[model samples]
Target: MLAVHQLYGRQSHAIDSGRAADWAATFTSDGEFRSPSYPEPSTGTAELTAFAERFHAACVESGEALHHVISTVDVAATGPDALTSTAYLQIVGTPRGESSRLLRITTIVDELVRTPGGWRIRRRVVLRDG
Candidate 1:
C-alpha cells in the first residue's frame, strides 16, 4: 500500500511537472490507458509517451498548468504480484498567472502489477463524472 501510494504520487508529480517521458515510465511496457477525455485509447509504450507529450504540449500551448489529485484510493490485491485500485481524481487547472480552478472530476480504475523496478500500471480506465 505504501508503494502504491508512492507510485501515484510520483505519477502525478511527473505529469504536473510536464515530464512526459517520466510520466509514461510509470506504466508497463504495454500498458493501456482509456479515457473519454481522449479521442482514442493509448496503448503500449510509444503511444503512452506520445499521449503524455501531447498533454504537455497542449498545456504549454494554452498557457495553463494542470494537476492531477488522486484521493479515496481503494486497493485490492488480486494476486501476489497484482492488484487493482479505484480512486477519485480531480483535475485542477491554473492559467499562467491566474487562480486555480477545478477542471474535472473523474474516477480512475487501475490494474497494477509488480515489476523488477516497482509497481507499474498495467491498465487504466478513467470515467468522467457529470
Candidate 2:
C-alpha cells in the first residue's frame, strides 16, 4: 500500500518536472490513461510517452512550472496482485515571477498491478466533478 502511494507520488513529480519518460515508465507496458476530456484514451508506452511529453512541452513553452499535488488518497486491495486508489489531484501552476495558483482539481482513480519492479498503473481515469 505504501509502495503504491509512492509510485503515485513519483509519477506526479515526474510529470511536473518534465521527466516524461519517467512519467510514462510508471505505467505498465499496456497501461492507459482515460478522461472525458479526451476522445480517445492514451494507450501503450508510445502514446503514453506522447501524452506526458506534450504536457511537459506545453508547460515549458508557456514558461510556467506545473505541479500535480495528490491528496486524500484512498487505497484498497482488489486482488492479490491488484489494488485500486482514488485520489484528489490538484493541478497548480507557477508562472515566471508569479505565485503559484490552482489551475484545476480532479479526482483520479487508478487500477494498479504489482509487477516485478513495483506497483504500476494499469489504468487511470481522471474524473472531474462539476
Off by over 4 Å in 1: none
Model 1 lDDT per residue over 9-65, tens place: 999998888887888899999999999999899999899989998998999999999
Backbone clashes, each candidate: 0, 0
lDDT for model 1: 0.92
lDDT by candidate, in order shown: 0.92, 0.92
The TM-scores of all predictions, comma-separated, are 0.97, 0.95
Backbone clashes, candidate 1:
0
Deviation of model 1 at 1, angstroms = 1.0
